[model samples]
Target: MAPAVVVIDSGENQEFEGKITVYVIVCVILAAFGGLMFGYDVGISERKHVLKNNYCKYKNQSLQLFTSCLYLAALIASFIASKVCSKAGRKHTMQTASNFSLLGVVLTSAGVNLEMIIFGRIFLGFGIGFAIQAVPLFLSEIAPARIRGALNITICETPTSLIERNKMEKGVKVLRKIRGVENVDNEFDSIVHACEMARQVKDPFRKLMKPVSRPPLVIAICLQVFQQFTGINAIMFYAPVLFLTVGFGNDAALLSSVIIGLVNVFSTMVSVYLVDRTGRRLLLLEAWEAILVVIMVCIFVMGFAWSWGPLGWLIPSETFPLETRSAGFAFAVSSNMFFTFVIAQAFLSMLCHMQAGIFFFFAAWIIIMGVFTWFLVPETKGVPVDSMLDKVWKQHWFWRTYMADDDCTTVVKVV
Candidate 1:
């Protein structure tokens, strides 16, 4: 066998400055507003009485519908967001989502009836779905490969914004702005190469069904399902109720919930530093699954915050080939929203029937998630999106399996 020929343009070998510019930081901060809006909407349900007070004559069911309606709208929007992003560009998609969210906010604030509130909620959901789909995709495309993982996690977990679009020219500009990326043309050419390869396949969805695309897709969807089924949302939704059950008063329970919220924010910040340094696979495999299961609820959240908290958004953005990236992310995001709805709706009932068994049920799922991560998820630290498909295909049956140099010469021998 011969060595593979790799070409490097003369200008591509220059050293990077290794400093993040204010422009890059500002863009990331702006893109992260979507996450802030998402958190606010999810948390605002706890204060539905404000809506009830404004409307004066609403039933309990109507209020429930108002609170949960955004998820439903998001479900519908998720299906179309990728298509829109692909056609209009990521920046436009985000702007459109922002418009939708702004309109929803205005309508909800000035609503005189149930119909107005419902429409407002639906619009807000539509915007959130689009923002959720586009933000990470944009961030991943624009970031420098060295710190891309950290940037994606930071933007997902913190308040970061996006650049303009996915076009090679704009992408190159964004990359040039990042520290340690002295040769923007080479990186831009790589993106072009990926896009060219993607162009050969006429149908993105059909391409995704092929062998090379299947593993990443499976890993992505499975991680999403596991993330939701682990009962994070259930605990988040009913923290007060759980506290009451555990012998705390209403005031204490509410205070406990506030403390949990603070923990969530802090943990998310911690993940920003760890994601790039420790790598996504190690964090998911070792941090959560191997250790932290003692304190039950609090510990579980810590594990989740470290592992799935950022990787859930980071991995799917990087896993898919350029051709199928948009559609693939759409599928993953929609699956996340769907399962979130299912778990949020079913958790209380399961708690009622199972009592102390609910935590055990979630524990079982978390164990399965750990096993899946060890076997299927590959280490993607410092890997480029263009080469991710090849990386996935080169892995052993179990991702952690090790082979000697002689055994790993060719694809066939490795398999």
Candidate 2:
């Protein structure tokens, strides 16, 4: 990193002039561990499976089960994770997730049979479910502190957020520890107001069904669906196999996949810089780059890494109101895990049957998602998470209607 762009609070609030304390950087890295856990399982499982495929009689089915099982377990976890997050706070939720991941890894690494591996994958799935469910919302909440640069600033929740959880004294103490000489009262008040409004809603999940939640929910779910359908995971999950199908030897195929994974990692880091500057929609629109589509595998990996990979999480996490953030994002995470399971389970079959046409199939989805991003998705670059309804959704021409009530006349502005 770079220093963050200064963001003045919109509407009626004082400027947030906090610097990037080391604590914030630590939080950012903490959030990143979940993603690394996810990517590692996807790639490493395939590498091992692919190496042993020659001796296996049912390679496709076994590969599918091993690779896709984690996603299925994660999908189940996503359903329950909303309540856990709502009741237990993000720190506790993440702690639970990491526990599941560690235990799952132990079982998986020590497995002696397919039964053991599949059983271990179930735990891995639960970890994935909880991790994805909490991490994005965590990032969204913390990321607002610095609109640009890396997205986070503390170990525990923000000081003002403790007020929402009825830990006002702790919140103030923690705030003082993290913040320098700058006034955090306005920011504190803003968070409290958002939490107050959220508290008034007895059922955040039920409220998620209302028109106010429709745009972000729709965007969140669709983005996850599109992200998987882009076939990035299909390639990622079966990278070595995909390389072999595309005309590489065993050693070469494995090597290429490793390179692609590295490219994916590097490009994702690039998004940390480009995201706030170029805006969410523009980064998403990078998929429509025809040149990249026709280019090399690393180029394709680079394109997806910076664009869909990061935005899929970033946009959805920041889009919801405080009341529905956890509940809504659960659906998003579930959608992603569900489709990831489907693709990871069926991709090898699809690859064998569809052959060269598989690329075209995913490419078509890429175009459709690109069009969706342009026409339907609103730009959510600089807006605070709590202000999305007023500053982002209500402002978008297509989504504005959903934010209105039955007054038929005077109401406050949305966008």
- List clashing residue pairs in candidate 1: 28-160, 28-161, 29-160, 29-161, 30-161, 31-160, 31-161, 31-162, 32-160, 32-161
Residue 87 in model 2: shift from native, Å? 1.3
Score residue 11 of candidate 1 by CA lDDT. 15
Clashing pairs in 2: 24-153, 394-415, 395-415
Candidate 2, residue 270: how far the Cα is off, in Å: 1.2
Model 1 over residues 1-415: C-alpha lDDT tens digits?
Answer: 1101112222122222345556556667678677776777765654442322312122244555665678778878987998888777777788888999999999988989999988998899899899989888877765645566666523221111121133545455545555334554543454454454456667878766755567667877887888887787776666666665654555655666666666666777777778802899875764453223213556667777777877888888876655677888888888888887677556656776788899889889988988888877888776655444344445556431333333222211000
Deviation from native of the Cα of residue 409 in model 2, angstroms: 13
Lowest-lDDT window of 10 residues in candidate 2?
406-415
* Clash count, predicted structure 2: 3
Ten residues in sequence with the least summed lDDT for candidate 1 = 2-11
After TM-score superposition, the amount by which residue 165's alpha carbon in candidate 1 deviates from its true location, in angstroms, is 9.0
Q: Using Cα atoms with residue i matched to residue i, what is each candidate's TM-score against the true structure?
A: 0.77, 0.87
